[model samples]
Target: MEEKKMGLMKCLFVLFAGGVIFLLLLAIYPFWLLFAKVTNLIGVKGIRNTSGKLQTPVVFYEHSVTKRIVAFVAVIHIAEPAYYAAIQELIDSLKGYKILFEATGKLSPQEEQALTQKEKDISSQFDFIFDLMKKINELMSLQYQKDGLTYSASWINTDMRLYDLIRAFAQQDISLIKKGRDIDDPFTEEFGQTVARWFINKLFSRFIPVGVVLSVVAFFSRDKRVAKRLILDARNEIAFQGINEYLKDSDIVTIWGAAHLSGIEKCLKKSGFREVRREWFTAYTVRDYSLFDAIKKGMRATKEAASAATALKKD
Candidate 1:
């Protein structure tokens, strides 16, 4: 009876350990898949180094029949100043190439001032998100794209208007403004807005990494289809249209967010463009002090301390 009990307990312990390992792998699989997809889209083979530094890529595609070149300059919104400088230098080198850049509903000062109250309110909500992004940039010791890159008057904007985006989201029954609101709450829209603002303020105050926060927000969003359709598909279609209409047989240079590149690449491939060259740029290096690094540092400190003690004894 004792032998049988021992065997049963061992079996149960093995099963429990296996279950825990399976659960851990299951939890990690989605993140690994996402990372793989992102790297594939941006033409990055291995994004991270041993030290946890990440690199992004810029891909160049050429039309098969026309032989015209199109350079897709993938960019992060916030990165080291040197990254933007390298991008600017690349743009300067392509002197005659027409630049197609990404900016949605950018308004002139006069146009901004003339917006109606509702429009102003909607704009302010978007501005709040941008402000949070800027705060994150500052927290990460990174430079904002707007400050880092010089914009040219000649570059074309291949993005939709803010009102158009709102309409698209509304069609999908997704309210961008009320996105964070509690559905069970019995309150006015103003109350919801206030609560949302307070929540965002608290969230940003914690100084969480922007990428992690964005991934969490995306994962928790109620309508993922809406985001895919409006943010990625529709925007990509507009960019494709701009390329077709404006970039007729000219060596085109596009500056867009790295996330948007996959969709744009699909469109380009369908239009006879194939990726010819790829270059990786180091965006930022996060210093991850691993166990080995910590041990090395501790040993150096101990050696220094011992040397100091020996000198004190000699004195």
Candidate 2:
């Protein structure tokens, strides 16, 4: 009887451990898949750490038949000012290339107001996302893409229109939105509202790192499949159409989000463009500063400011 009892206890312990492991794996599976997909699409050189600085790739592909060059300038929306400056300098150097950029073309005030109520709601949600991005920029001390990069009139915008995007989402019967609304029905409205308020408060906390906030947002995003399909896959097809039109005569330089690079690369390859060269640019560095180090840096800045003021007075 004692031996049987011991065996049963051991079995239970093993089962409990296995269950925990399974849960952890399940929780991380989506992120793991995303990482794997990115790696496979862009290779190990796509993103890397070089001496503590995170680097992103700028890849150049050459057409086999026409010999025209197509450069994919992968960019992070929020990054150091210097990184953007470096990218601008590179763009300036590519004098003859036709610039293609990603942007959801804007809607005029009249057009915006003309939108249906469902479309307006969808548009408002997008506005909320941009507002959230601005808050993140403030907390992270990073430059936004719009402020960092200058757009020339000659550059082509190869993305969907905002009005179309709003309409698309509005027309779709997205279960994620439906489910969230259902949670706010008379039965669970109060509890749902309380939970939402708590989440929003925590999400905007300064102490939370930008990366953690973004990761949490991505994890909890209602419908990843629908969002990715509309935002990424559809946009990629439009970009490819623009590239195809320009690649016949002009050398093309596409400045697009890093996530879109893989799709663009695949499209180029299918059209007989082979990657000729690749370069890595340092996007940002992770600095782990002690409290003393922070204080010393602050003191140095104060001294510099004083010196600048003294020079200005003298002049």
Candidate 3:
């Protein structure tokens, strides 16, 4: 009976250990990401630039998403230095565009404030999985850094009311979105092979050394939540960004997650927009170092503490 009890205990230990490992693996990403964000607060001193370079890949001979010739820009959201730089460059590049329609879902502060206190609380909780995501998404938001950007939630999905958002997740209807398609649109096959290839490429890249490199790049990047925040919400504004712009402007620079590019392309082509050119940016490098960056932060912390102590002594 003692031996039987010992065997059961060992089995339980193994399961417990496995569960712990799984949980840690899931969390390791946010850990490194948080570390990067924290270090960024002090600046990347002694760090040999742990960021990815900007490259615009012109892999599509035609409009990658819409099959119509439309100008589209792709940014890797989960990658470092590359993500931050691409966003600013994209914004700055848009010098005199009369209309800038942002499909990336974000908070409208003044608009939300107009709501009643109860409505405000309900509204704030819509996009947030945790309170931390809400705060993080707001701070690290990119489009708001520049003027003339509008948050148009209904551009992608017309019925995105506050209550509709709350109920969609409860009904588990989000999963069925991709499974359904535009039954009215017959030109879907123009991108069929291309979309299939893109999916397979992404799948294989994640399993290979490339994926490992991407993981490292993601940590070094700031505002990782900004681009990724779209993934969690039931409404995907990224797909509609291109077409939404097409309705108002001839020249459009749509910055969205790389994975969402194809759909945006399809939407653009359906609206008669065309891609003019493409560019590629470097994402990761082994030459960059972060050890000294961490040390510099430590040193700064000590210096601040010492100064505080000196002030207290003088007092």
> Best candidate, TM-score-wise?
2
Candidate 3 residue spans exceeding 4 A from truth: 1-69, 76-82, 98-164, 170-249, 271-274, 282-315
- Write the candidate numbers in order of decreasing TM-score: 2, 1, 3
Tens-digit lDDT track of model 1 for 1-315: 999999999999999999999999999878866764454344322232222345666889999998888888888788789989988888899877888988776666776776666556556666766766665565456798777889988888888876666545655655445433333242223333334334433332222233444657777677764666788789989988988876685888888877778789999999999999987776665543344444455557667777888999999
- lDDT (Cα, tens digit) per residue for candidate 3, span 89-142: 655655543223323344456555556554444444443333333232232232
Q: How many clashes does each candidate structure show, in the order listed?
A: 0, 0, 20
Model 1 scores what on Cα lDDT? 0.69
Worst 10 residues of 1 by lDDT: 43-52
List of clashing residue pairs for candidate 2: none
Candidate 2 C-alpha error for residue 103, in Å:
0.7
- Give the residue spans of candidate 2 off by over 4 A: 1-46, 175-222, 289-315
> For this target, which candidate reaches the highest lDDT against the unseen true structure?
2
Q: What's the lDDT for residue 167 in model 1?
A: 49
The order of the candidates by lDDT, greatest first, is 2, 1, 3
TM-score of 2: 0.65
Count of backbone collisions within predicted model 2? 0
Please provide the root mean square deviation of candidate 2 (C-alpha atoms, Å).
13.4
